[model samples]
Target: MSAAWSAGCVRARSMLSRRVGAGGARELASRASLEEVLQQLAAGPYQRGIRPGQSLEDAQRAVAATVLWHLRVLAGWLPREGAESVRALAGWFEVANVVEQVQQPGTPPYLLGSLAVSWPRLARAASPEQMREELAASPWGDPGGSDPRTIAVGVQFAWAVRVAERVPRAQDWAAGGAALLFARERFLAEQPLAEPAVRRAAVLLGADAVGSASFADLRARLRGDARWVLSDVDGPGELWRAEVRWWDRVARDALKLLRTTGFGPDVVVGCAVLLGVDARKVRAALEISARGGRPLEAFDVLA
Candidate 1:
């Protein structure tokens, strides 16, 4: 391995070591109050993002911010191509920023800093049309049209494609995510598939799958690794489990990647995914704690 790859892999593993493991997260959930949860987090890697007495939404965003910061640090340790791959994975933040910009322009955007694909330019967009134009000019490509919903969905599909193209190992992850997106629109939200979404789905999952008439049909249309994400999902109410299963699958695959790969981008990517999974588990645990639910209650959604 090159010196940069070696250093980056080392940094990745070090960052992974700092995660609050599944057991630790469950323990946090078992705490008596959010106060106790916050106290526990203050002594860990989350201390930088979390604070005393923050609302659940704010606290979750803080956790996400901290994870993004970690990704930025990891990216700094890598060479050009590896850093670009990290940046591709990090595009989800940029996608969130854009969606928030369209849905609630007054909301303050997440500070993406060096990991941004086009937030610097997109932030200045005064209208959805301007945002669409800015995205077309940037790495995100055209958002189909200026409709806020279309723009939101377009950017997400674009992010998935970017990840698949830039980090080949993440192809299954990207496909699985896109399949879930389709399921959400069709089953959970019960909204008709818009033209832009249909086009994107056709491109991502193929023509036959895009024409799925129901959730069962959609799940049946998926092949190979992408099909497994929806294997246990039966209906809209069960969609949450599909998301939970997605996280579980990601953690499992990422761990395997970490074990099999040496000093390379795969190691860095695996580490990044694991960090994301840990952060998500922590956030879920905090949610359960805030609700005064038992720790075991969290395992249903978290396990």
Candidate 2:
């Protein structure tokens, strides 16, 4: 690795060290109201994101923006290869922003820092079809069709392939893409696979694995880190738990690699990914708390 890459990794590792843990998120979840959650956030890394008298929606948007800001700074410091991997990972944010714009046109923007340049065009999209066309010309590519849901999934699949190519051992993205395809086949759509993502995943996971009735056969077809997605997952109701577990395993493995390897882009990329997952967990917990639900008996901690 170059000296710049080494220095970037060191800086990123330092930043990752300050990320909130699962216990802190659970504490926020235990709060009786959104006000209390904001109070807790008032004194932490998320404090800057919490505006005075901020509603739950506003706070959530701020938190999302904060996570993107961290990623932006990390990407700016890394070498070309490292920056490429980080940008590839950040592409997921752009996909999500597209979905949000399609679903809620007038909503405030909470996009990735790297994608600020495109926000103007996306914000002006009069309809979902127009937004889809705009994304087609971008790195995210066409979502196979004009439908919003399909576009989201297609963008995700494209991102998975891109990340897998740019980052070594980044199998989690492919696994996630496969999981979504299987979920759609088994529970949501219950039809033959037609989307490009499903076909690509099928090449490695088998053409019949997605629609198969037997979970064992389906799991057996997955390779590398993708197989873990099916562990202990019985049906659609249990899929969320399975995903949380899978991400936990992926994040831990990334952290382990960061620990064992010498200075390189992997460390920077891994730190960004782990931090992003941590932010996801925090957001999930906050949503439950905002709903006035009880403390996380049904939720799996994502540290």
Candidate 3:
């Protein structure tokens, strides 16, 4: 790690320490309405983008923008070595942009903040073939380039590959790969295999391990470090629970990284991840509140 990367890590540590923990998130989640939520958030850093009467989707988008803006600021403090890791993480949003385009080409883009500069070009493609051709030179490569469904699978597959290749730690890579496999299998299990692109993504993401197979088989193929995520899952319906479990593991790993006094790209990545988790928890809590439920009753802090 260069001196600049270390310096960036130091700055990230200072910023991350001030993040709202579970207790604070619960307070935000306990609000009775969007107006109350806005008032509470206005007392903090989120007040700038979030406004009164904002719909849930718009509020979430604003929250995303705030998080990405923080990431951009952190990236500016790092050297290329540190900055590249942050950018790699942000690249997920680029894949998301493609997914949105495939799902709704005519609709305006919902995600506004992205580190990838080519998102505009990729987002403009009206059809799967055009999108695949546009992404031919990108890291997400072409996944047989057929239709929107196939292109979506290909984009997700690309993300799985990048997670394994770009993350610096071997253990973290294994966890991430396992999470992808679990989510993909659970989700695609419902989709008909008549689509060739979906079938390809299934194979690439190891979805076959869970298809028409017993939980025993699925558990056997998972990475050893990640097997615990499925210790309680018995069937497909329980997969979302397993996802939350995996997120807990991720949060723990990130917290462990942040605990160190040292500074580097890993610290920057940890801060970004922790902040993202915080936002997700807040959203989950607020969603529960919107549904006339109390905070922390439905969702708990993973870390």
Top candidate (TM-score): 1
Poorest stretch of ten by lDDT in candidate 2: 185-194
The reply for model 1, stretches above 4 Å from the true place, is none
Judge candidate 3 against the unseen true structure and give its global Cα lDDT, from 0 to 1: 0.65
Residue 215's lDDT within candidate 2 is 55
lDDT of 2 by residue, 77-127 (tens): 887787777777776677667777777667766656663435556667678
Higher TM-score: candidate 1 or 3? Answer: 1
Per-model C-alpha lDDT, please? 0.84, 0.69, 0.65
Tens digits of per-residue lDDT for model 3 on 95-136?
Answer: 678877777666455353436646767876778778888877
TM-scores for every candidate against the unseen true structure: 0.93, 0.86, 0.83
Instruction: State residue 30's C-alpha deviation in candidate 3, in Å.
Output: 1.6
Worst 10 residues of 1 by lDDT: 294-303
Best of the candidates, lDDT: 1
Model 3 scores a TM of 0.83
